[model samples]
Target: MALLDNGVWSKRFFSGGWTDSALDHPVVEPATGDLLGMVGLATAEDVNRAAARAAEAQRDWAAASPQRRAAVLRRAGELFTEHAAEIEDWLVREAGSVRAKAGFEVGLALGECFECAALPTHPQGEVLTSEDARWSLSRRRPAGVVSVIAPFNFPLILGLRSVAPALALGNAVLLKPDPRTAVSGGVVIARVFEEAGLPPGVLHLLPGDASVGQAVVEAPEVRVVSFTGSTPVGRAIGEQAGRLLKRAHLELGGNNALVVLPGADVHKAASAGAFGSYLHQGQICMTTGRHIVHESLLEEYTAALAAKAEALPVGDPAREDVALGPLIDRRQLERVHAIVTESVAAGATVAAGGEVSGSGYRATVLSGLSTDMPAWREEIFGPVAPVLGFSTVEEAARIVNDCEYGLSVGILGDVGTAMKLADRIDSGKVHINEQTVSDEPNAPFGGVKASGTGSRFGGAAANIDAFTETQWVTVRPDIADYPF
Candidate 1:
């Protein structure tokens, strides 16, 4: 495959249509600094048009039979399966994911589409009967216009995780994908909606930068905003939506922690911890940025983890042997660099891998970290793993809960010991014997505290709550005759 130059954008699909125009940012391979292709940039007018089209199509789409909606969603899953290789290629090229990581994300996306399709049957209503010649019932109705704003990390899967559920519930969708990987994966998803024989305008893909997104959020027609990204941007989107009195579902930033206890399998825990933090170069919201090690085991545990991190293949993301990839852009690289620099100034020791090569930063490990260091206090959002020493399991658990952001936490130790610690951590999700990466299409995923508001990607049950509104029907003919 030939690498592309800067100034060329590829539009896989859009509201107006597919147009491969030159985008603003040149798609560059992180490790090699090789240009791949340009991503399409959507303008404010584009958002307006997309929102209008979705609103126009929503009435009919919401009225479509549940069975029919489910069939479309099923077909989408099949289409995704058939095009798995192509999608994986795009993920590697655009998002800089290793082949294994790309494959995992694609598989998750397919599963989400399938799970979302089955939601119609799962969205059940409640029935009530009254003795005084009156009856009541409640049903879930579509939320009309749903605007899905996705992050770049898991471009395809996370994007679909939000939009698929909305579409399956008979809502018209306007998709605003991450600008970095906006071309093929997102376009392919919109194409799936089209292939499923969805009416025109039922699903609109507007790929662009921040201006386009701000416009989409401000549009009067877009009633609900589903967003995933950093805390600052998520807060801005929430404030904008609040101005319009619109509904918002946000899954924002995380500073996940991995606690290693004295009784834990040092080797097993070290390997899992390395991958959880360094995979995707630590761009994941659920990535374990903090390693809270028991004081008794801190030295040996850090050594084991440093070796595992050193052994990871840090080469081309497209290669099957590679386990780590480059930071998406220079901005992320700088952010990681600043956090590491600040930690060192605060007296944290760099244990391993803290160098920057081209767009990729070395998988970093820091020890002797104090709670006051920026790396310990904030979401590093990089491969810099900072280890903090803790005297007791209670202290370890307390340190994890002290962060303003409580998204996910990983506890590694004996089954009984881990569970006991887990009972005290104030995070949205907890993992035992592993890093904080658990997969259950039916499970709820989100954060608490400053991690942002609400939740998303939960199974059919929770999605039913997100995409639908409840209406209570009543029969009170006798009450009409009597005034208050």
Candidate 2:
């Protein structure tokens, strides 16, 4: 099934529709190393054009009645569900996501759309009593044009998480999807909004690389920039947006840790750890990269986790029985293998699968890892989990918070102890008795410290503030009584 028109993808989507560019890049299916299609690459001029057109559309979209906007968004959500099957297939091929991962991403994205639809009608302003005979209120207004740069991992969900809210809040959006998964990330998104009767020029889609992304960020027409990707690139985008004095909401890299406290069910914690560490081949930013177990339970927990990891079926994503799929490309595969190799050489022992097999790597588990190792400190973004031992709750908290990235953490233990330790951890989110790979449409999701820029997205009220600016308004009926 060809995803693009005549097997060719468009680089631009404006008020008019999809437009092809002269320069295009090939998109390869990672599972079979097959050519899926070609995605048009956006140039600097294309980014500027997209921004200008989005700005033009923002005027009308922002002026539309809240009910009208909400209606359109609700329709879009319905359309997304209607086309879930096709979108899931695209996601599997274009992003190398397995069946479960693809389904979760699409489902979450659909929920985001529906959730954002209600945002238009939600209370956006507040009234406050003033000391003088003046009524003070604050109104939330759209930030005009927003630039969304999404990563390859969970592209659809991440893209729509910001895009849907921006649209509902009366902001025109210019989305620059990662070129690798343009079909799932950019094309499918534009199709849903178009079919839902969104007016032209309101939502623009551009598929491109870093240069094109930089163009969108630097463009004066784009009032806000929201990005989800690696920390290095996010830092560059944030710095540029800061220099330009533009609003930037960033969800970046994460080295999330999953902790198993003493007296916790070893079997249950192992199952959750296995799922969190290897889901989507550990491509998710919130994937459990480090497994911190109480020293009392380390041996048993590692044994159970190793058995689970070794038993997971790894093969092509298209296969129904395969639990794990290929990496996005050979480079990622090599990087993952290198991390495993280096960690093992640095006194870490591989407790489970470690070798690269076929198009994917084995679900590898390493034990006896120190904080000095790169595998423990860096964002692996792979199916490798390094297990570390801690004796006390304080020690566990220290291990979890020692990492530079503080996106999320998973704790499995007594509820009271878990909550107490969670409070001590420096992450933005903590999941007790659950894995780190969790998300909800109504939950405020983002990271802290090096993981992100401390901006939250996903909740109804929070999204409005993220995509819009607040203006304090005060009405004084007796202006003549003032000092003037």
Candidate 3:
């Protein structure tokens, strides 16, 4: 698992069957600082090459029978499930994921692939009414070339959510996964498609940094761009894609809220809140960034959440049995801790776990947050749960709706009340009694406002809009010329 080139993957790190780039970056395991492997660093020119090759291969792929495309996608899912253990190990070492988190990501990726396999046979077009005596219809065609840019956190799932559907719908993809997690996010996908007998050049995996991604969005062959990362980066990509007149489906950052209503079971609500905020070291986009509780349960809920944080374990996920793993790198650790410190300095209280634990920050709970503190206002992206107390249900909803990013929100308490309050929030995903960290293959997942471009990425209906284009055609027994 420490090396990139096993029997499963050939060419070490380059699996696109293209000429290897001279520049490369060493993938280092952050928990132990061990050298994992080397990944290619692609350039702007490499992006053009990949786009051109994908364009060439996409024509025949779109013309291929639907059964052929379905078979390839289904086989890829099977391969992923069969090698789940090995892939989990890679995720642990390369992406700093705990065993449980790694397993969840692999399962999600497999399910996404399986779901997309059924997309090829799904209805493609519909009949249209014509004003004249003619047969009229609309046809769904591939977008030609799709560019998928993924981030390091939850890389495999994010990358495949778009990659599988685009490929299944007859569109070629140029995948630009974050260089830090190239093996798990980029190479693994390329290898799986290769093993599944995807035609050469149809799926190009380019592991690189931001510059190559910019090139991918600007490529002439690319008709659409799907990006999942921070809000700032998604914004930049959206601007660039807008200038190019391309569709950019972005799933960006979230300062999501987990609200605990007045009548909820304190212990149960605290458990859900803890999991939502601290899962995977709070690296997920839908992590409960804000914990809004009714004033009646604030004391008990915060104490219970802090106790859970104090009791949990954290360490090297690859070597030890722990509930949480290290942050992706030192940069992440610094960013997380800085926010906690700044918030505490601004009159917030650290209920539990405010210290640095090796390469990670311990699961932290900040109480007495004034809603203006950084820990409560900003997207910490760490295992820090900031609690804000509210007096009324209307006030709680207002607190939840105050964030700039509207990605996901979770409300616990009375189901009727929760459902009623859900109508007031503007997030993309809402969980009535569950936490914010959740997803399903059949669900349309995306965000609104600063979180994304108000477009979704999962489910058949959403995928059709994301990966394909529509054209109208009319036939009337030869060309009965009109308005000439």
Candidate 4:
């Protein structure tokens, strides 16, 4: 097996230091049955040290002028563009994302850096001078150490997006990347930040699995915990954060619903769903796992969607022609397969894709879905689509809103009606005449209800809160009220 080790950066170069070894996990290439590498694990002590270093660094880094801080972020953006192809290759090899998806993710990361760089220039402070010689001013200050926990699906972009805003806003960061894709993606990030001249101890990369994450969250030095992962895991992190009383920002699993109206373009909706649902093997949290198709077009839409799923070419993710690929690992593949198979056995129709080979499973489509079925209730993080037919818009809305998970939902109909219904959906994001993959960095992306807490990638207001705290200043000057 190839041995991929942790990469730590300091003073514009790799520190040649290693995180404390707590064991190791094997990284595997799912399609070829080849072992990619093994990564050294990090213990609770390592987390504590990283967090303390970040806190210590934040004092000086936050003192820098906004323009100076933004310059570093902007420099990182340029570096990302210069190494786009190299970054994309790492993404494909490590995360098993299709070439196109990996490219898109890289571009998104570059754009996010530019967005975050511009955040500091926004006029924040307010100064007031009164006849009574009273003065007041308010400003935002960095929150010191922040611990970032990333998911494997979009390892590079999702994780670094949080890191960018936190760092650009003057907060030092300790990033705990997902073990599945940590080697290539997280290492690339560390290298780029070092090249951009980030100060030592300001940014640290911790490579490990779930236990490492728990250590980071429990550390007192870690003032903030920003996590992206499954809903259950997010909940666990939230509970731990509550016990520690540290700020927690979570982006969790989404069983996104798509409503196809009677007058909708059944062909268009089916095609969109087929491509959207199976992207990254449907490991994406915002993927459309549940379909609420109109009863009138149920047969036609279901058949069309099944055909689309069958037509998709699944192979190695590194190839440009391959449209779909295997799930990240055996555990994920087994979990997703079990959910679909059990749903079918519980009276849900298996419209397509019931076979599995090795870690690769066929892109599946299920029709005649009942609310009681596992496919309907669970967030099957795989390329399986279960569709329930609805008679009217109200019925579709009811079915879509019934779920406790509501991160995103799509409306497949005339733009006017879709927009109207989008307002009622109990989800963090709504797509009109589009799929769930259409995410904009300027818009706030997150969930409602049990999906998650707080938000990411909206604008300065949404992200500023992630890394900064407000300070209130007041001066009496010469005259003061004597009410007290």
lDDT of 3 by residue, 1-484 (tens): 3223544333243435745566788888989889977777778888888889899999999999999999999999998988889889999999999999999999999999999999999998999998898999998999999999999999899899999999999999999999888889988898888888899889988777678888999999999999999999988999999998999999999999999999999999989988998899999999999999999999999999999999889899999999889999999999999999998899999999998899988999999888788898888899999998999889988898888989999999999999889999998989999999998877999888888876578889999889999999888887787796
lDDT of 3 at 410: 95
Off by over 4 Å in 2: 1-15, 478-484
Candidate no. 4 TM-score: 0.93
**Colliding residue pairs in candidate 2:** 15-200, 15-201
Model 3, C-alpha of 426: deviation from truth (Å): 1.0
lDDT per residue for candidate 2 within 11-42, as digits (tens), equals 34433577868678787888888887677777
- The candidate scoring highest on TM-score is 3
Q: Give the per-residue lDDT digits (tens) of candidate 4, residues 155-190.
A: 888888788989988888888887777755566677
In angstroms, how far off is 38's CA in candidate 4?
3.4
**Superposing every Cα of model 3 onto the true structure, what RMSD results?**
1.7
Better of 1 and 3 by TM-score: 3
Candidate 3: where is the Cα deviation over 4 Å?
1-18, 481-484
RMSD after CA superposition, every candidate: 3.0, 1.7, 1.7, 3.2
* TM-score pick, better of 2 and 4: 2
- Highest lDDT, which number? 3
In TM-score terms, candidate 2 sits at 0.97
